[model samples]
Target: LYAGVGSLSNIGDQGMEAEEGRAAIWRLDLETEQAGIFASGLRNAVGMAWEPSTGTLWTVVNERDGLGDETPPDYLTSVREGGFYGWPYCYWGQTVDDRVPQDPALVARAITPDYALGGHTASLGLCWMPAGTLPGFPDGMVIGQHGSWNRSTLSGYRVIFVPFAGGKPSGPPRDILSGFLSDDEKTAYGRPVGVAIGADGKSLLVADDVGDIIWRVTAA
Candidate 1:
């Protein structure tokens, strides 16, 4: 079984940077019950999936903050074995975060992510949807952007779709569930979190934290 660790507040501010054994994905051997790190340097890898075409492991990462509202974009990428993603020292593949202590050696080895999901989107939920799973949607990843309180805007309060072809993202992201924020932006009607396929195998299930609702998405 593969599981993720977590992220840090303020992007490792106050000497909380990614250290020797933090912010990593661990692969556990169920037979023997042994677990070890599979990848490191991911700030907050919230959602994970398996691409059906290649069976490769992929994830959505919530990156560091304080570089303005849009410095580093949260990303989606394939997880390579023993890969380092540059959490504290740099972001978006070696851009160099001045806030964190410098580390040229490790930054040089950081892996560039495959796709960007915009800054502070807080994209959390991730589920694999095959072609035609939803009436008009194609094969892709379904993500829930669990809204946060720090941003000055509605950066992430809805669900989105990133189309995939072969084994990678093929097109622009499309809105799956939106209208979460109010017209005045004072109240949020819903905040999406976890995502999954319904038991019937034809519909999508989304968890709305703010409204406490599990939305069932399907063809009308």
Candidate 2:
């Protein structure tokens, strides 16, 4: 099994000393009673799912904030074993972050993610959808972006569908649920946190944290 571990502070604000063994995914070997870091440098690897076609593990990551609104974008990507994604030193593959001291060695090796989920979307939940389960969805993935609190204009707060072709993101994301933010963008009606395929195989289940509700979407 795989489990995610997030960093203690943003961009090692408390110092690199505080970031030891953090921002990584760990694999547990129950038969052998062993556990170790499977991947590293992911700030918040919240949601994880395995693709049915290729069995590749994918995750939606929440990138760092406080670097203005659009400096770095959150992303969804297939996880690479023993891969290092930039955290404090760089973002989006070699885009240096001035806030943290430069690390040329680590920055050079940071692996770029497959797809961007927009900056500061606070993307969290992820689940794979097989073809024919939902009309027009095809074989792809569904993600719940909980939205951002720091930006002037809110992002996310809805569910999005990303179509996949050949086991990779093939096109732009399609909005499944929206309007969580108020008309004036002052308050939130609901925040989407997680998504899953319902038992009926035709409905998509959503977890809304702010409204304290669970929503089900089905083709009419």
lDDT of each: 0.86, 0.91
Per-prediction RMSD in angstroms?
A: 1.5, 1.0
Q: Residue 115 CA error for candidate 2 (Å)?
A: 0.4
Q: What tens digits encode model 1's per-residue C-alpha lDDT throughout 1-220?
A: 9898876555566565335556778899999998899998898888999998899999999887777677798888899999999887788898888877787999999999999988888988898998888888889999999875666665888899999997999999999889998877899999999999999989999999889999999988
lDDT of 1: 0.86
RMSD value for candidate 2: 1.0
TM-score, cand. 2 vs. native: 0.97
Clashing pairs in model 1, backbone N/Cα/C closer than 3 A: none
Candidate 1 regions with alpha-carbon error over 4 angstroms: 14-18
Clashes of each: 0, 0
TM-score of each model, in listed order: 0.95, 0.97
